[model samples]
Target: MVDKFPAEQQRIVKGLQDAVDRLNTIARGVAPIKVNKASEYFDLPEASPAAPGSGVRLYSGGGKFTVKTSANKTVTIPMADVANPANFTSPSTQTGDFASASAYTQLRADCARLHDTVRDLQNAMRAAGLMG
Candidate 1:
């Protein structure tokens, strides 16, 4: 093929082939990049609000995770409060005993309330993408 081409073209082809060979050799000697797990777990600086009309920003500090929206709205969650069942309590203010005539009726009412609370929690978890 080099003989069929003009001298200048043949020289250019040779140079290109040499460049490709050199690249292949360099690629073989290069190690594949690896992820550094330690670097991935670095602590973030103090939380700051995101600019309005820009985008949301996530921040972590003081043992809490904060998300600030472009509208300057922010929500923070404590890291220690995550996935702790004891931290999830019903906001219901049903302080008094069940208003039932019989003990059996009161027990049933209490059980129903408990079931509803659990269901609400599960729904919340699902909405947050923490539960399947």
Candidate 2:
């Protein structure tokens, strides 16, 4: 003959699941923090010259007590041929925000909770001799 769990035991299990679900529901609107996006590959003047088929050209650009011997022209410029670097600049901003460790932390927490709950259920079932 099969033994059944008491009603109180079933109620306890159900209540635990309900509470976990409620916690998840309440955390739905957590917006990630906005990260300040810095540009990589900033334009550096060739300081000498640009050869054909080369992206680096020797050009001069500096002024106002900064570059005393600044060259008058920019060389090997990347933007010289390409139109609109802005398109490549924006999406990287998610507004292209990378996933921060904090986000991973939240995800890790969720996964840990999920794992623990699943383990709890598995152990409970095993104890009750209901697991295969």
Candidate 3:
């Protein structure tokens, strides 16, 4: 139990919890993706206040969704997933440097797996009629 931790450690944990809660709140308001004008059916973020000019833009003639970050990094999401947002595999990036190239690559793969898990959860929710 948290009660076993020293008072100082408990305070630190509480601080981290507060920080996570704040981040979650910010994530909730993130702008949705904007699909390219040429794309007949796709949705991507219009802007990401978090990434500033790195707002997501759609491309691939509605077959792909691309997002460019200020750091010149690009992320692509499948058009099918964009059309069915519930199935989108939202990627995550680790903040720190990796110990080796292999480590980095594995981490990236793990992140993809996490996204797949998210899609699975979404499917379960929809099957239960929890989502429309």
C-alpha RMSD of each candidate structure in angstroms = 12.5, 36.4, 27.5
Residue pairs with colliding backbones in model 3 are 32-45, 33-44, 33-45, 34-44, 34-45
lDDT of candidate 1 at residue 125, scale 0 to 100? 61
**lDDT of candidate 3?**
0.57
Candidate 2 segments whose C-alpha is farther than 4 A from its true place: 1-96
Local distance difference test values of all predictions, in order? 0.63, 0.48, 0.57
| Model 2, span 83-126: residue lDDT tens | 22122211223323458665556556666666766776666555
Highest lDDT scorer: 1
lDDT of 2 at 106: 58
Stronger candidate by lDDT (1 vs 2)? 1
- Kindly state the number of residue pairs that clash in model 1: 0
Best by TM-score: 1
lDDT of 3 by residue, 22-64 (tens): 9999999998766445547545545433333655433343344
Worst 10 residues of 2 by lDDT: 77-86
Clashes of each: 0, 11, 5
In model 1, what lDDT does residue 25 have? 100
Candidate closer to the true structure by TM-score (higher is better), 1 or 2: 1
